[model samples]
Target: MTEERPVRWLDEAEMAAWRSYVVATLRLRQRLHRELTDRHDVSLTDYEVLVCLEMQDAYRMRMSELAVLMGSTKSRLSHQVGRLEGAGLVRRGRDPEDKRGVITELTDEGLALLATAAPTHVEGVREHLIDLLSPQEQATIAAAFERVLEHLSEAES
Candidate 1:
């Protein structure tokens, strides 16, 4: 048998910093989610999906592609799409090239809603995050997040 190795552990400061980061991220997301949902009847997930659709060509995307963009499973995306469809915010159609595939398109109402809510969302972001940081700090934080994303992508591959 191979010899057992000791487990690596965080130093006290590292542990504290990690814990604070975790708590702050969770709390901030929760607060923002609550604010968006309460004010506009749109969940953060809905907003994210809408944003993704809006940025795509023709304000539409393949269902599978949208799922990837949202970091969600197809089934979950289907449910969310259904909700948005029922709200008159989106529409679904069969993909012309692939019979088995579906496409999602944002509606005019969805665009209008986004236009109304974006300013409030931007203000909230500025109040809670952006404005609190100096330009240098903001750049550093963005770079750090990009590094984390790259690491995650590499690990997945």
Candidate 2:
């Protein structure tokens, strides 16, 4: 039988950092979701999806690309898109250059809704996260997460 290696465990400092990050991230998302749902009748994920499309040219993006950007499977994204479509917020169509590819486009109604909801979302973010951090702390957090994202992205390829 192969000998089992001893696992390195987190010490107190590391555990505190990790636990705080986990809980803060979860509660932050929940608070943001609650604000959006209460005021705008939109979930956090839906707001994120709309924001993603808005960042694209002409407020349109390929379904596959969107799925990747959102870190979601195509099937799950499809269901989410379907719900948005039913709400008249977005629509899907074939990409003209590639008939096999599907494209998602934000509708005028969607843009209006996003415009209305933007302030509430921004204020919530500022109040819940940004205002809590000093400028230096914000910069440090951004840099640290950028490194984390870059390392994880490299692993994906």
Candidate 3:
């Protein structure tokens, strides 16, 4: 067998950049979550789920598919969906094609809540992020994130 090679460490600049990126991302998410929660009484996760459902063709998606899209486990998703259902913001139904599968659908109340909250969320995003970056910078940032996403997906595969 060939000798194993030692792993290279990040350079000082790279280490600093990585830490800064992590800190900034965490802070941004926290701020966004707080803003949404305080103003709309909705958790960031709930807002994400609502957005996902609203964007779907029928304002609904299979439970398993939603779990994957939300980057959550099926159990966690089920719990969240139950909470939303209790709040009368969402509903669950048996999938038409698959008798054993469940589908999550957004309620009219959920859509109304999303409509009310979306403008404020967009404003917060503009104030905290989009407005701060020049158009070219925005494009560059998007491209960089796309590359990172592609790299991560490839790694997973």
Candidate 4:
């Protein structure tokens, strides 16, 4: 029989740090979402999808690949992509390499929306998160988060 391991409880200081980080991250996400939606009529998730597409070589990527990058389930990405498509911001096409696969590309309208949204998004990020930290502090926080992300990626593998 397999044995269950005991939980590793966090100490007071560690717990406080964890709580602060969680609260800050949650608030940041909420504020960013509000700012983008209020100013640009785009959800934070939608903007992130656009960002991934924008970063691709031809401003397009396969749906499955995008799901992995976005850490989204197949159906979740399908729904999000469908909404973007309905808004005329992006379109889905059959992958030339594999008909079974779908590729998503940003439309001209989508690019224009991104152009409108990026400034507001950047400003919110600066006002709420980035500008509040010193350069060294930002680097340290980023490094710490990278480690956490690496652990998550490894756990999934």
TM-score of each: 0.91, 0.96, 0.92, 0.96
**Best model number under TM-score:** 4
Most accurate candidate by lDDT: 2
Candidates in descending TM-score order: 4, 2, 3, 1
* Model 4: lDDT of residue 61: 96
Once fitted onto the true fold, the runs of candidate 3 whose alpha carbons sit more than 4 angstroms away are: 1-5
Query: What is every candidate's alpha-carbon RMSD to the true fold?
Result: 1.9, 1.6, 1.8, 0.9
lDDT of 4 by residue, 64-154 (tens): 9999999999999999999999999999999999999999999999999999999999999999988999999999999998999999999
Collision count for each candidate, in order: 0, 0, 0, 0
lDDT of 2 by residue, 1-157 (tens): 9999999999999999999999999999999999999999999999999999999999999999999999999999999999999999999999999999999999999999999999999999999999999999999999999999999899999
TM-score of 4: 0.96
Worst 10 residues of 1 by lDDT: 27-36
Candidate 4 residue 44 Cα shift, in angstroms, is: 0.8
lDDT of 1 by residue, 1-157 (tens): 9999998899999999899889988887777778888889898789889999999999999999999778899999999999999999999999988989999999999999899878777887888889999999999999999999889878967
Give candidate 1 regions above 4 Å deviation.
Answer: 1-6
Q: Give model 1's TM-score versus the native structure.
A: 0.91
- Candidate 4: give its CA RMSD in angstroms: 0.9
Looking at model 2, how many pairs of residues clash?
0
RMSD to native, candidate 2: 1.6
